[model samples]
Target chain A: MQYLNNIGTYFLMIIELFRKPTKWSVMRHLILKDIDDLIIGSLGIVSFIAFFVGGVVTIQTALNIDNPLIPKTLVGFATRQSILLEFAPTFMSIIMAGKVGSFITSSIGTMRVTEQIDALEVMGINSLNYLVFPKLVAMAFYPFVISIAMFLGIIGGLTACVYGGYSSVDDFITGIQQDFQPFHIVYAFIKTFLFAFVLATIPSYHGYYMKGGALEVGEASTTSFVWTSVTIILLNYLATQLLLS
Target chain B: MIEVKNLHKSFGDAHILKGISNTFEQGKTNLIIGQSGSGKSVFLKCLLGLYDYEEGSIEYNGEVFANLSEDKKRDMRAKIGMVFQGSALFDSLTIEENVMFPLRMFTKLKKDEMRERASIVLKRVNLEDAHKKMPSEASGGMQKRVAIARAIVNNPKYLFCDEPNSGLDPKTAIVIDNLIHEITEEYNITTVINTHDMNSVMEIGDSIMFLKDGLKAWEGSKKTIFKTDNKIVTDFVYSSNLFKKVREAVLKEQG
Candidate 1:
């Protein structure tokens, strides 16, 4: 019952977030700031995680297929599939649910604690729209970050495959290109977009509704991280089942 | 003027405000004074339309708030400026940008115009040189002054302050009180303040409403606050021995 209540509240909040829009002059600055905070700020960590994980996935795939009868190119195939199909979109979002999600939650939760939200409301501004809408708009660029992750992941896999003697550069390149479905990129991005929405809203829900002081802001951020990751994973499973299976 | 009629508010099973009604006049500092848990904050929030009251009508310059449409309510709210107990300045922006925020949101003024207007208010609040600083870098007194600057930057017709001097030293608190008083007269605004600071009550409370457990225990000006024999008002106002002796001396002098 409590879960249902929260879900209903979250939906209501999303609806409120779009209504009574803030003036574009103010909203423009807020959107730019959020882009800097939520998207641009996340690039470095996402790139680092994607590169190393892609390398590890390639090395592990190579070790698993020790038989000479198996084509060495299969290592590249598996790495490409892992990084694009799951690693770049789903795994990276889980990581962001910690980095970006905690940031959104803590920043907003602190505002709530200090009555900044009330200040906005009293000023006749729609606080939900003012605070959360920019984030939602910024997360529209989430796929841009994931695209970078996908590119770096493949590059890292290629470097590892060539350097680790897992496969020749030619074979790895062929494997990446071989039988690749354009639809998979679309499917991955579809999931990325959904996760992006989750990333922005779930944490905002925790932050905007949070009640308490400084200690509670920290607690809200942790809860927001947990819930955002959980929601992203759940949505990934649902999307995969519907889109892939 | 702001008038409240039979305001009532409750939270779940707890009734926070039984019924509160009072008129806060314009061009003067109107104060709501009560001990902790006496629903002073709640009453102020209800007046600001931040909370939904169970029963009551609040009239702002004779327009019943509950009767207005959402758009009208928002239009009304736009005329209000509030200074929170915590100052509630945006942490991300510089103090100058913080003061300019309401103008940015509500006006179509050019950036230079907004900056100019912000400077005017900041100067009014005696925050002439702190524009580049963040709220976190400001002292409590400075932050309160910035809050005042932000509140009046948009030229609101009504100003509400929730303990605008909460954590400041006595000297700074008096400065804030005097600033609010001056702004009230300058703007001819319907100013309502929620505070328990007796010094504020005595200094600038042109009209005072004393709430006890959500009910109006007494209503008077700062002059009458000392003269009132109402025990609730006297007990809360003179809880300190120094104030008690001062009240006694005043009574003797008056007698």
Candidate 2:
């Protein structure tokens, strides 16, 4: 019942968030700052993680093929498929659910604790729009981040496959291009966009409505990350079943 | 001027503010003073339209607040400034940007113009040299002064403060109270402050409203509060030993 109530309030907040548009001059600065915080700032970790994890996934896939009859090209195919289908779009988002989600929650939660939200309200600003909308706008660029992850993951996998002697570079390239479908990219990006929305909003919901003091801000951040990851996983399943199946 | 008539607020079977009525005059420091849990904060929130009451009406300049449309309400709110208990400065921004926030939100002034306007208010609050500093680097008194600068930068007609001096030393608290008082008179704003600080009460309680268990128990000014015989008001006001002696000294002097 409480979950239902929270869901209802979340939708209402989304509605209210778009209603009173803040002056674009202020919103422009806010949006750029959010892009810097949520997107550009995330590039370093995303690149490092994507590269190393892709190598690990390739090495693992190469080892799993003990059947001597299996083609060497299959290693590259599996790496490409995994990186594009789930690793880049879904798994990377779970990582962001920790990084970006906690940031939104704690920053906004601290503002609530310090009565900055009330100050905005008393100033007649729609605190929701002022605080959350820019984040939403910035997260629209989440696909850009995922694209980098996808590119780096494939590069990492190619390096592992060729250096590990699991497959020749030409065979891996052929495997990557053998059955490529453009729609797979579209589907992955669709999931990325939906997860981006979830990442921006679920954390904001926790932070904006959080009560108590500093202790609760930490708690809200944990809860928000859990909820964001849960929502992204659920949405991934639903989107796959609906779009791919 | 702001007027509240029989304002009532409740929270899920807990009646917080019950039929409280008062008029806060313009150009003066109007205070709502009460013990903890007496609904003083709730009353101020209701006046600021942060909380909606179930009954009665709140009027600003003779226009009923609850009757205004959403757009009109927002426009009215833009004319009102608030200083929060924690000084609520945007931690990420420099002091100058914090003061310039309202202008950016509500006006089309160029960046230089906004900076100039922000400087004027920062200077007014004696923070001219602190523009590049962040809120985290500021002392408690400096933060309070920055809050005052932010509150008045937009030239609001009404100003509301929630415990404007909660965590400061006695001297700094008095300084904040005096700043609010001076700004109230200077801007002719309808200022409403919710506080229990005895120093603030004695220093700038131009028109004071005493709330007891969510009801208005007494009403008077700084001088009149010193002489009030209402037991509820007297008990709460003179509970501290120092204020008790001060009250007795004032009474003896009068006699």
Candidate 3:
């Protein structure tokens, strides 16, 4: 019965989200407050993953073929597929789930345990709408922006490849141009939107239900990040199979 | 007026409120007093619909509040105001914005009208120039006053306060108690307060309900408290060493 109730709550929350999405001002405020944290915390990790993953996949693909019939430049095609489809969106959300998700869960859980949520309820404000919706909208939009940042990290990797004489700039660009499909960008966005939803809702739900004092709030944040990261990885595999297949 | 009928709440196996019933009249300070973990706050939360009781009904102005629909509950909640125990002010908002929040959400009043109303309530709470200050900048007593301003800014039909004087110094506690009493009389609202402060009970307790171990052990006015022969009531009222000595001295003088 508790499980059923939780499922019901999720559906109700989704409906609530649709009924009154976050106000523009509130979204703007949350975004500005979190921008520095998101960029600083997520950029380095994503940059490292993007650069190293791109170079490693390029190197591995180039070594696989013994015959020179297949262009060695096709290594860049594999790099492009890996970066756009699976690496950028998934890796960024996993990193962000640790940074932004934990921040939101702890902040809101503290507010809940401190009776701030009750204060809003007494004032006839929908506490969920005021607290969670802004975060959801911000997370939804912000990840798309961060995915662009992830793409820049890929460019950094490409720069390294050119400077190290492993590949020419024209050849790398031609490899990407040959293999790139517009649908990959669409697929990336769909995955990003789904990741954002999962990241925002799971943590917000955990925080909203926090009951005890500071200790419970800390536990909620830790649990939210752990669960959200696991769910992101699991869903990444599922979404890739569904979309790419 | 507020009427609670046979309100029962239990946490798992522990019954918190057992068949508790009371009436809180309008235009007076109706206080619920008890020791820590005695369920006074829980009862107040039940009344506010923040807790779901397993059984019983609460009526506000003769309308049943327990089984109301979501929209009805929301509408009813708009007519209720609360001052939380910790003075739960929005940390991100300035004092003026905190007080102005409900007005902005519930009313289509012009911004100027909302600001004017907020200022009026702030002045009523004796906070005239602290509008621009954040809640963190205010003292504990000042935060309670800001909370009170926010509570009454909407001119609610019912006011509920949970430990309104918990952490303040004696003098400021008295001031807040008096202000809450004055507002209760001025607005003719049904005001319910959950408190353990004996000073508050003495000063503004127009009617008081005492809960002991989650049971309604005693109910009476301040004037009748001293005269009542209930042992639990007497022990709670005169438990302090100083109050016990005062009580003994009074008895000796009477003898």
Candidate 4:
């Protein structure tokens, strides 16, 4: 019953976002701040993980190919497919469910506890719009982060392939270019866009509607991350089925 | 003037505020005092329209609040300034920006104009030097002052404060209470405060209402209370010996 109430409330919050207009001056500043916090802040962690994870994927693919008949180029092919299809978009969003998701929940939860949200409401400000809309605008830049992840992840893979002596540069490059479909990149970006919405609103719902004080804020953050990650994971599979499968 | 008629509110089976009726006069500091769990906060929230009363009409300056259109509610809310118990200044904003916030949102004033007004209001609260500081960087008293500056910066028609002196030392609390009253008179704004401080009840309560378990138990001016024979009011007012001394001194001074 509580879950159903949350789902209904989440949709209602989205409707509220469009009904009340916020001052553009304030909205612009809020958007810029959120971009800096959500996107730029996550760049370092995303890049670090992307690079190492890409290297590991390449090494694992090469090691698994025990047959002499399978082309060495297949290692690069498999690496590109894995990183572009699932690793960059889906996996990174899950990581962000922990990183960015926790941030959205705790910051907003703190505001709720501190009566800052109440202050906004009393001032005739739509607290939901003031709080959540900037985050939605900022998450529009999520794909930019994923684009960087794709670049760095592939670079890390090539570097690992060279160092591991699993495949030659030309062979790996051939495998990456082999039957490369533009539709796959399009599919990855679509998931990123959808995941971006989930990123902005799910955690916000938890924090905004949460009850209790400081300790509850922490608990809400944890619960928000869990639900956000689970939602992203489910939507990922759903999107893959609808868009890819 | 704000007139709440037969206002009743409940949270599920709890039934918090029951048939509360009162008129908060303009240019005066009206106080609602009660023990904890007496529904003071809930009543304040209902008056602010942050909570809806299930059975009552709140008339703000003669227009029923429930009858106002959504746009009108927004306009009315813009006129209502609130100083939360915790001050509730935006932690991310500087004191200057915090005070200038409502202006920037509701008015098309140039940035310099907003800053100028913020400066004047902050100076009114005796916080001229602390504009660049954050809320966390200020003392409890300074934060309450900033909250007041923010509340009044837009020249609101009504002001509400929930426990504005809850955390301050006695001296600082008195300063804050007096400042709020002065602002109320200076602006001719209808101001309502929720507090349990007998000092506040004795100090600036031009009109005081006491709530007991969500019911209006007593309603009178500060002067009337001193001469009245009501047990609840007398017991609650003289609950502390210090207040008793203060009341005796006031009576002695008056005689």
Sort all candidates by lDDT, best to worst.
Answer: 4, 2, 1, 3
Q: lDDT of each model, Cα atoms only? A: 0.92, 0.93, 0.82, 0.93
Tens digits of per-residue lDDT, candidate 2, B79-169, equal: 9888988999999999999999888888888999999999999988888899999999999999999998998998999998999989999
CA lDDT, candidate 3, residue A124: 55
True contacts kept of each: 0.91, 0.89, 0.66, 0.89
lDDT of 1 by residue, A1-245 (tens): 99999999999999999999998877898999999999999999999988989899999998899789988778888898999999999999999999999999999999999999999998878899999999999999999999999999999999988999888999998888877999999999999999999999999999999998999999999999999998898999999999999
TM-scores of all models? 0.98, 0.98, 0.89, 0.98
- Give stretches of model 1 more than 4 Å off: none
TM-score of 4: 0.98
Steric clash pairs (candidate 1): none
Q: What value does DockQ give for candidate 3?
A: 0.54
Native interface contacts retained, candidate 2: 0.89
Per-residue error for A30 in candidate 2, Å, reads 0.7
Model 4 whole-model lDDT (C-alpha atoms): 0.93
* Residue pairs whose backbone atoms clash in candidate 2: none
Q: Cα RMSDs of all predictions?
A: 1.0, 1.0, 3.3, 1.2
Per-residue lDDT for A135 in model 1?
A: 98
Q: Can you write out model 3's per-residue Cα lDDT over B1-255, one digit (the tens) per residue?
A: 999999999999999999899999999899999888999988999988888899889999899986677778877988898999999988888999999977876777888999999999999999999999999999999999999999899889899999999889999999999999999999999999999898887789999999998889999987767567899989898899876776666566666
